[model samples]
Target: MDIYALQQDIIRYSKEIGIDKIGFTTADPFSELKARLVRQQELGYNSGFEEPDLDKRTDATLLLPGATSIISIALAYPSKLEDAPKGKKGERRGLFCRSSWGLDYHRVLKDRLTKLEAYILEIVPNATVQSMVDTGALSDRAVAERAGIGWSGKNCAIITPEFGSYVYLGEMITNIPFIPDTPMEDQCGTCTKCLDACPTDALVGPGQIDAKRCISFLTQTKDFIPMEFRKKIGNRIYGCDSCQTSCPVNKGHNHQIHKEMEPDAEIAKAELIPMLQLSNREFKAKFGHVSGAWRGKNPLQRNAIIALAHFKEEAAIPTLVELVKKDTRPVIRGTAAWALGEIGNVDMLSVLYEALEKEEEQEVRNEIEYAIDVLKNIE
Candidate 1:
């Protein structure tokens, strides 16, 4: 079998099967990535979401025995929401990041990888293969960068000239010895747009991120957003896009070629008030297919409350009061109290003190007291 010919065939098949880009690389250990990760750990920047074992994350062989080659695939998602509903007073909408605008990318990429896997296995009857998307120990960006799919950008995204940095990445490891593609040269060229645009200053340096301060990571956490970032998070319910949107290369690269990637404007930019009222079932029915929902509704709901505060939506004050007075989750109650402080005026001070007297959770009490103080200061 001509592995070279087979590689070309696989690339063509990938395009036919909906993969936007494909590249191959040797399945050697990612030494540079390991070093970077170690540095990230030392700097206390690791987001606990990653694979705990660093060894398995950087070595392809550790994941798939006898792996000789790796395949990296990119699927571009839409950047702009068509007919997006505008947020107005009494009708504020919280925005999910562009990456979560469609159905969860993990499923989308898995389907593509499965199709490619079957094609390769048919060609090489005894080929060993393993594939993974975001949840895998292997870093998809590291695999894609090494595979020549794109250069790692200063924004910590794999930026393909064709798709900018708005691409979803997934990878496969196989025993087949396909020729590796040459890695792309860095093209960022002294641009600091992404760095300057980061609201949280999470981009500690070019190609480096302090995940703890990253809005994308913070939005998914189940805790109350730190007071400092609550204002910065603004109307973002799931992720932040300041860095990506500010990139000059990404200005005109909205790819909606994949039908599954089309954003439903209503859900992607959902109303803050309605979102606050959604029961678990309602949230799942509306957002379960999207990747942003993977963290469940608590974080999204909490963010929605904060988003209401950001907009100073006087309309959501009633809902915020309800959450503070009756929500079972202390995080929700506390966040709502904080939002009340942000949005409610002097007139609402008495209502907050009333809730504060009955609040059982010490944390919730603190938030109510804080809200009272903020309202008083406003008077």
Candidate 2:
């Protein structure tokens, strides 16, 4: 069997199936990544969403027995949203980061991988293959880097010359010994834009992130956002793109090739007040298709409350007051009280007093008391 000829055939078929970039590498244990993961764990920089076992994350052989080579694939997503709705005083909008603007990328990338697996099986009938996207044990960025998909950028994204850092990456491990491609040279070269632009200084150093402080991570957490980072979160409801957007390599690199990746003007940049009142079913119906909805409606609603405070959207006062008074979730009720304080108007004091009287949870009551103080100071 001519492995070289078969690799060529796979590449051609990949293009036909909508894969933007593909590369191959040996399935050697990722020694460097294992060390870094250890260091990140010691420093508490990991997001806790990653696979916990270091051996499983860095050793390709553990995931698939007899694994000889890995194939990495990338799909470019759009950066700019065309015809995005304008945010005005009363109708303020919060943004889900560009990566979440389209259909959930995990599903999109997995579909591509399944097709590739089927094609490979047809050619090499007995090939043993295993595949995964972001949630998988192997880091997609590490696999992409080793397979020559792109250089690891300072923002920790895989930066491809063709698609910039706006690409979604996935990988497949197989027994076929395909010749590896050369990794890309570091093109970032002394650019501190991404590091400087981080809202919480989450990028502690180039290519190293403290996920705990990252706005992208903070927005996804189910609990209360730390007070220090709450105002810095701005209007981001899902993920934060400040680091990627600040990079020089990503300039003018918006690609809208995939139809499923196109942004729905209203869904991508949704109204802040409306989000505060969405029922679980309503949230699912509107945003379940997007990647950011993985954490469900609570975190988004919490961020929406913070965003309203960021803009100090006075029109949202009534909705926020209602949330503080009646929202079932303590986090929501507390965050709403905090937002009301940030949006300080004399009239809101009456609502705060009413909530303070009825609020049973100590956390919610504390937030209501804080709001009362903020409003009283305004008078």
Candidate 3:
């Protein structure tokens, strides 16, 4: 069997099946990435969500024995939300980053990868293949960069010339000895826009991020958002796009080819108030299809409360008061108290005092006292 010809056939098949970009690379260990991961761990910069074992993360052979090549694929997603709803005073809306705008990209990319895997097996029946999306042990960006799908950008995104950084990445490791594609040259020279635009200064330098300080990471944590970043999170309910949106290379690169990726303006930018009251069943029914909902409702609701504080929407004061007085979760109750304080309407001071009397959690009581202090200072 001519492996080169088989590679060409796979490329053609990928395009036909809606893969925006495809490339091949040798399945050697990612030595540089291993070092970086070590440093990131040492500095406590990693988001705790990554696969824990460093050896498993960098060695493709460990994932698939005798792995000789890797197939990397990129699918461009819609950057622009067409006909998006506007947030108003009485009806404040929170934003989900562009990545969670539509049906989960994991599902979309997995579908494409499954098709590619089947085609490869048809050509090379004995091929050993393993595939992964974001949740996988292998670093998708590292695989894509090595496979020539795109160059690693200063913002830590795989920025394709065709799709910029607004692309979903996935990879398949196989024993096929396909000719590897040449890696792309880094095009991000002297651009500090992404670093400057990071609200939490999460991007410590070009191509490096301290995930602990990243607003995107912070938004997904299931605790009270650190007070320092509550204001910085703005109205974002999940993830953050400040770095990607500010990249000049990403200018005018909105791709809307995949119908599955088309944003439902209502769900993507839903009103913040309604989210505060969503039951587990209601949250799942509405947002479970989106990738951001993977962490469940606590993080989203926590961020929503912070968003309400960011907007300081007095119209939401009653709802915030209700949450503080009656919500079961202390994080939600505490966050609501903080939001109420941020709104700083002296009229709500009585409400805060009333909740303070009944609140049992020390943390929630402290939040209530803080809210009372903020309201008192306003008077």
Count clashes in each candidate, considering only residues at least 3 apart in sequence or on different chains: 0, 0, 0
What stretches of model 2 exceed 4 Å from their correct place? none
What TM-score goes with each of the models?
A: 0.99, 0.98, 0.98
- Local distance difference test scores for all models: 0.92, 0.92, 0.92
Candidate 2 local accuracy as lDDT?
0.92
lDDT of 3: 0.92
Q: What is candidate 2's lDDT per residue for 132-173, written digit by digit as tens?
A: 999999989999998899999899999999989999999999
Predicted candidate 1, C-alpha RMSD: 0.8
lDDT of 1 by residue, 1-379 (tens): 8988999999999999999999999999999899999999999999999998899999999999999999999999999989888988889899999999888999999999999999998888899999999999999999999999999999999999999999999999999998999999999999999999999999999999999999999999998778888899999999999999999999899899899989899999999899989999999999999999999999999999999999888988888888888889999999999888988677788788888888889988888889888988888
Per-residue C-alpha lDDT of model 3 across residues 1-379, encoded as one tens digit per residue: 8888898899899999999999999999999999999999999999899999999999999999999999999999989988888999989999999999899999999999999999989878899899999999999999999999899998899999998999999999999988999999998888799999999999999899999999889988887777888888999999999999999989999899999999889889989999988999999999999999999999999898888888889988888888888889999999999889998799988898889888889988888898899989999
What lDDT score goes with residue 39 in model 3?
Answer: 95
